[model samples]
Target: MNITIERAALLRSLGHVQSVVERRNTIPILSNVLLRAGDGELSLAATDMDLEIVETVPATVGRPGGTTAPAHTLFDIVRKLPDGSQVELDIGGDGTILTLRSGRSQFKLSCLPVEDFPQLSSGELKHNFSVAAADLRGLIDRTRFAISTEETRYYLNGIYLHAAKSKMGSLETPVLRAVATDGHRLARVEMPLPDGADAIPGVIIPRKTVTEIRKLVDEAADRIELSLSDNKIRFGFDSVVVTSKLIDGTFPDYERVIPVGNDKVMEVDAKLFAAAVDRVATISTEKSRAVKLSLVRGALTLSATSPESGSATEELEVNYAESPLEIGFNSRYLLDITQQIEGEGAQFTLADAASPTIIRDVADSTALYVLMPMRV
Candidate 1:
């Protein structure tokens, strides 16, 4: 295949596809990206068996054919090339080498037959919907931080996405919720359900897929098209399509973990709370990093102590009118949940020191967090 593509366009497309190619691969073909030139466009595809990304960029095609080249190597070459240079790619006479020419630089890259590349099956998707890019991005950012990294309990290694009835104001409304937990802290965010999404199946979107889709939606204002099957999900937008396999495990019922009827309530500035936690945590031991919260009439005290290091205590004014309560929590976990609060103050409902605590954003009823307390 022979094609002439502007360096800027080619570089952008390569940036999207090459990320799927792993640095080390057991299969040689998995390290290569398939490139096809036809119909005034160049198509780039890369896959690592579990995830596949395809993108198309406008180009001037001299020959209509396809080949596979090292994804990372080609990306590096294009990235280092002079801006605005027209890159020309042509298959050698032997059909085993791809010659790349731009400006005065020329390079011959080893090629593999496009037929040898594995293509992810696009099964009949049972659900398809379009959601605003901002909403989709918010769902990912608010919950992904809580995804578990442990491999043993693979079910908790992803974000649980489903449609549920939620109180959006005073009336019950359909909403899409993303929930993630690591047995220590949980994050849940909801957005208005999209059209044609009523029949969508609840699935666990792998952490990697969430990360990739987040990058795609950054700074994008257009709606993203989403398609889902029993085992796979696809996100399409801006001439790019990302398909990923769903985690084949059942996510634990999260509702039971959320605390209910917790009468002790406290409201504190989100930023102030996080900063106090951070400051007091400095004296905490590396292993525990535990911070203790002491609440009384109208003040909250954050303190941390380590036998070897030192101790710290910080007081902050809050709106709490409950009996005295002392709770110990991992400082990192507290900071993580507090950072997710977009409102001025974070509201916390507590039953006791041992029971889980419920946290919410004062301005957004659609998001909530549950954090399990620790022993100080």
Candidate 2:
């Protein structure tokens, strides 16, 4: 196949598709991207067996054919060439050596049989729905930080997405829910269920899929299409398609971990509170990393101490009329929840020094984070 494509357009798709390809592959053909030229466009497909990403870019086809070539090598060759340069790719359709030409640069890259490339098949997808691109993005960004990295609890290593009973109000019974946790902290967010997606299967989008979904979300688009079956999930938007295998293990019962009777509530500016915690954390012990929060009538004080380093202390004006309380939490967990707060004020609820603290944006009840308290 012979085709000419704009460097910028080709590079954009290659950058994403190649990221899904691993640097080392036990199967030699898996290291290459399957290129197929057809009706006015060329498609590039790459997969790491578990995650598959495919992109189609518009091209001027001289001869319609296909081949496979090293994705990273082709990416580098085009990346170093001048911007806006026209890249001409030609393949014999027999899946042998492929050729690349740009300006004065020329390359004959070794190719493998395109038939050897793995294809992600969408077989009888039970549910199909459309999600606002921004909403899809929010669902991942708000909870992904809490996803467990621990390999032993493999089920919790991804975000658990399902329909959940609404937490705040009486009228709204259930909403689409996304939850993530790593034992110490948990983040949960909700959005009104989309029309066609009501029967969507409860699925765990693995860590890898969560990452690739983030890239598609960054594009300035209004909506995205999602397809899901028992084991696989696929997302389609514009010229890109991303498909992945869902974790087969079951996620933990997250609702039990959510505290309901935390009576102490304190409101503080998110930006200021995060800044104070960051400063005090500098003096926290490397292993424990605890920061103590002491709340009095009208003010809150943050302090941390380490046997090897100096201590740090700071204060912030807060809105809390409850009795004084002292609590310690992992500084990193506290910062993560606060960073997601969009508005000026963040609401914190606590029952005791050892109880888990609940945090939420003062104006938005759709998102909430619960952090387990730690000893000082």
Q: Candidate 1 lDDT, tens digit per residue, 1-376?
A: 8999999999988998898889999899999999999999999999999899999999999999999999999999999999889999999686789999999999999999988998884676879999999889889989999999999999998999999999746989999889999999999899888888888889999988888888879835588989998799999888999999999999999999998779999999999899889999999999999999999999999999999988999999999998999999999888888988888989999999899999999988889999999998
lDDT of each: 0.92, 0.89
Q: TM-scores of the models, in the given order?
A: 0.97, 0.97
Q: How many clashes would you count in candidate 2?
A: 1
- Tens digits of per-residue lDDT, candidate 2, 1-376, equal 8999999999988898998888998998878888999999999999988899988999999988888899999988889989989999987655587889999989999998877878875465778888899888888999999999989999998998886668445565668889999999999999888777778778998998899889777883688988888689889888888999999998888889999999999999999999999999999998998999999998999999998998899999999999999999999999999999999999999999888889999988889899999988
Residue 139 Cα positional deviation in candidate 1, in Å, after optimal superposition? 0.1
- Backbone steric clashes in candidate 1, count: 0
- Runs off by more than 4 Å, candidate 1: 168-170, 219-221
Give every collision pair in model 1. none
The predictions' CA RMSDs to the true structure, in order, are 1.3, 1.3
lDDT, candidate 1, residue 146? 99
